[model samples]
Target: MEALDSPKLDEHSQALVAMNEVFQRQRKDYLANPYPDYTSRIRDLRKLAQLVQDHKDALARAISEDYGNRSVDETLFAEILPVLEGIQETIKHLRKWMRPERRRVRQLVYPLASNRLIAQPLGVVGVIVPWNFPINLAFSPLTSIFAAGNRALVKMSDRSPRLAAFLKRVVTDYFPREKLAFIDDGHQLGPEFSALPFDHLLFTGSTQTGKAVMASAATNLTPVTLELGGKSPAVVAPDFPLEVAAERILFWKLMNAGQICTNIDYLFLPESKVREFVELTQKIAHQRYPDLQAPDYTSIIDDRSYQRLWDTVADAQQKGTQVVNVFPGNEGDGALRKFPLHLLIEPNDDSLVMQREIFGPLLPIKTYRDPQEVIEYINSRERPLAFYPFTRNKSLRDLYLQRVMSGGACVNNCLLHVAQHDLPFGGVGHSGIGHYHGKEGFINFSKLRPVHYQGFIDGLKPLMPPYGEKSRKILEFMIRRARS
Candidate 1:
């Protein structure tokens, strides 16, 4: 099947046309049966599980070609593993996930028990996936969509051109084009995809693009989930373990060469603890992953992103800030973009790299004697998508958790929060909007319709007539109870 069926933006894709046709059929089935059937959803997930396991090699190969040489090991662990795990977890809990939750009613509806929420699937959804981890990003949230029993039309990244080609093949072979669809063009059809009358839309990409998506979604009044980037800070008070914090930050900061939305964007350490944390990370770098070019570490996604990272370093250098060299020979212009990793220190807030989300392998450090000042810095900017504080001390983690507002939080580590199937994943403020994963993931793509059933008995009708002894007594009791 052709990846892009439309010759121009005005004309849409044949794949997309085929997708709309499928939606028409699926929509009929959906309206006829709005309630989710947990068993059928589980069956579909089993098929998806088989597809991921069977196409593991092809998926990895495609991702590697897109990254020019991102190791297959990296793709398997980062992309394939997460997708399978999310699907598996959802399948294991589908029955419970589908059951209508019961909530007690007020005294008025005595003996007429109420089922609080019936999670109904949205008719159709559009998922805008990022290029960083094409397979995982596309399928992870998709698991919840399936678990909720909804149809999805996915827009694969144009950056991952090769992977797009391969993913399209896999998508067509296993699932009907209407049940599941993939778009593989250079963002030309993105607006059309977003403007489709999907019940809900989920977009994972940069903040700038997220804004555009929001504008288009407004046209149809479609509710959306935007998982965009931010300057997500990692704070380590004096109480945290220096060695553990260093290694934990390094693993995530360097993951996908810092092309992660929730990766530690920067760090704030106590002035007294700065030297100790920095030195320990330097030691762990040599001991744990001796070679900076190890197979486990993937390169930056594209040349444009690589150059953008280097530009941040250059701007910082011009402003007289010191750049922390994490990898040997990963210095100067020649090898910088090819293998980028840096521990950056700025003179102050005025410094260049300290300004915005450093979406690269650069880790900017700031020493703070007062944690409140750091908290103020966080609030000063737009709320972040995710925040981290690597501290074993309960008080410290709790303090940050209580004071700061973000999409999600992880204590003593990073990025692990996103994978926990029990929690929700999303952003706040300018970082992005809405979150969907696990139970929350399912609900985000569903409509929680409340059906209130009243029995034949019209008891408690005394309040409607002229006030009498029983009505007056009940009204007085209710008022007193409400005050108390």
Candidate 2:
């Protein structure tokens, strides 16, 4: 097979010109076939699934190369599996989701009238995928976009160069430019990409970048779904065992080296159990990753990220925050870029680690005297992408579920909620906007157009513009009935 040419980054204007050409082609194709049949949609989804399956090993290797040493298991589990599962789920329910929903007609328009909602496909969707979990972030949303029977144009993050290049080549080989295309521009073309007049735009990245995408999208008044990340918190109820909390939290935190958007950014532990929780987390870390330099433990994505994590920890320590390296002895060689998990205990509010989303193996543990304090503390900050509460107590779990506002929540678990094909995954407030998973995802890329059918007999003739005494009498009767 001939190698696909990578996008040139000589000039931003030239890149935009190329990007717009692709977008227009997709738009034209969409116009040709606005609503695809169930069979056609299923074919598209299945083709995508098979493409992923065929390239699974290659994609994993490219991702690992991009991250220096990302574990194959992590890529398979966090990125590949979710996408494959999501594709199957979409295939299973596409027919039902495509069915028009019957709605009730008002009494006034009752005679030979009916209402229904048609899930019409938006013309074209633009998806901006982030670096971390690149495959899942790109393909997961693409599954929904395809399920909704729309064309798509994806922009991969420049940070994951190898994966981006690999996907650009593979996607082109598998899909037509008008049906599905990938843009792997290693330049400052983000502004231009987001500025396109797409039917719908979905972006997954930092809160600051999300804001810029939203701003650019405003020019076209394009509807957007911003999956932004923030300081997602995990609260360990006193009733829950420290061991369980530590184990579950470490699983997510250590995954992708804690680069996940939904990973617990900080922990709210019961004040008395703080020390014990730390020890338990350390023990769990040791058991899971006995050697820090092992391939199972993912390395930091790049030099910039490695330095950022180090700077965060150093700043916290300087501000009188207690720093505990979970694996103290085995500081992997600098070449490997594998940094052990660092626990920041009670980092000051002004500390960098506490203020920013530490997208690394640095975990900040905050203590709360009362569960209510935990609630108040979490609420005081911006709502996060996810909230995890490890509690077996029904009342406490319900309390957290009701009180704490997050994009999504998991009870007694971490990060599994996003994997559920039936549930919608999205963030709230600063975390994200809109949802995309299962039926909700299908709806996200579709315009739920309400259609009404009426018989030849005009039911509203009595209430026409040229109202008379008869119309007044009918209005009076309706008012009396409403009042009664």
Candidate 3:
């Protein structure tokens, strides 16, 4: 199926020209008035926030159309609140955050050298959003971009052109096309969008696509924020609440129909408690949403995703894995995209569900005996964008936190770590590069300038004179003393 796209989008060639002009203009404009000067920048951010705030309902409505059936309530809380909150928080903290950092003077130039770290805005930033959680994912990096006082050009996913159009309208109303523009297009434009020589780039999507975006960003050596997805996993200890854990996990697991980047893709349960956990999970999911494929229930994002969910279930079933359907006729004939709520059982790791990420409602339970076995299981795969463990036990949580590494993790819950605006959000290995949200977000979009102001006493000035025994001895003495 073709993805939704705006008819108003400038064709690739024309879009390229517009962006280049904007980049050059903004670069000169920014150079003329460095970002550290807050008047114009703060004015711009307030305008942008007002624009977004005024159009909140329209944005949510458009997104609901694109997703076929999206949760407007969830979108408001997850997407809109976060973006506005980011703006508020950034405004409150920007002055202190942008203040120059002081550094210790080196002994070699103790009296002569004064060191400082200055913050500078990385010029134009490019942000590409994914269809799922479009506004939150899109505007999130905007927080950092504004915090660093950089102009931005954004490209909203064509899959959600309705929402893109809504954003494009609001943004254009408040921002100059040069200061901030939104490009709405499909696959034909992905490569060219990535090729822009923005000072920084942030692309949020699949791991495979993130690689391509990174490669293109490298053409200009632009640093990239790759918020890529991997099969993020959740582990449930034997001591945790089976019913509550299953309910909470399945609640979030199914949010946006499991299309979320930080969504728990797979689960590892305590070996001895596998049966109990599965039973509870099935009961809760059934009770919560008896009609799993109804209009209110979120459908697969698109047909390709629909087929993918189908394939995962089909392959697992064919491989002799038990596919449980708690609701009568939950599993369909595979004709319509409303396939089934698959409580797929892969008693062995070799099954299809176990082989890759199930970015759908299908939950495959993998059992682990030892706590170390769970850690080893996590280590075996590429690092996840988000790791979740549901255990109230402090010691086990601490042990897991120290041993297992992920982009961001939660002990008693899943993915909520990302919602906390105070923590830095990012992945470690295969999930992502660089951090965003809170303080790290500000740094990610900034160029940290290491500055050293130097003036000399006559004694230090002699060290820079013609190579003489006195200078050499003085340098040696400084080096030795510095090392000591």
**CA lDDT scores, all candidates in order:** 0.78, 0.90, 0.78
Residue-wise C-alpha lDDT for candidate 2, range 1-484, written one tens digit per residue: 0112344444565667678889999999999999999999999999999999999999999999988899999999988899999999899989999999999876574577889999999989999999899999999999999999999999998888888888777787678999999888686678999999999999999999999999999999999999998998998888888887787888889999999999999988877998888888878898999887889989988888888888888899999999998888765457878989989999899999878898999989898888889899899999999999989999999999999999999999888899999999999999999999899999999999999988667878888978899999998988988899
- Model 3 Cα lDDT, one tens digit per residue, 1-484: 0111445554665656655666677677667766647766677668767876998898888888887777677778788898898778777777788788988976445666688888888888899888888888877888778778888888889898888777767676787775777777743578888898888889888888999999999998989988887878889888888887888887887777777888887788876776787688768877767775565466676788888777777778888887776555555533335545667665456776776666777778777787898899888888888888878889988888888888888776788898888788887667889889887888888889998776565446677868899889887987788789
Error at 432, model 1, angstroms: 2.8
In terms of TM-score, the best-performing candidate is 2
lDDT score of residue 466 within candidate 1: 80
- The residue-level lDDT of candidate 3 at 240 comes to 85
> All candidates: CA RMSD in angstroms?
3.2, 2.7, 3.9
TM-score of 2: 0.96
Model 1, residue 294: C-alpha shift (Å): 5.5
- Best-matching candidate per lDDT: 2
Q: Model 2, 262: alpha-carbon shift in Å? A: 0.3
Can you write out model 1's per-residue Cα lDDT over 1-484, one digit (the tens) per residue?
3434445533445655655666576666667767657777887788778888998998888887787667687688778887888888887777887888887677562445454788888878889988888888888878988888887778888788888877778776677665677778654667778887888899998888999999999999999999998788889878777777888898888777777888898799877777776688778766755665555666676778777777888788888778777766655233323455788774457665677677677888887888798899888888888899877778777889999998888888998888887888888878888877678888888888787666566556767778789898888987888899
Candidates in descending lDDT order: 2, 1, 3
Look at candidate 3 and give me any clashing residue pairs.
407-427
| C-alpha-based local distance difference test score of model 3 | 0.78
Off by over 4 Å in 3: 1-12, 15-25, 293-296, 332-340, 347-350, 456-459
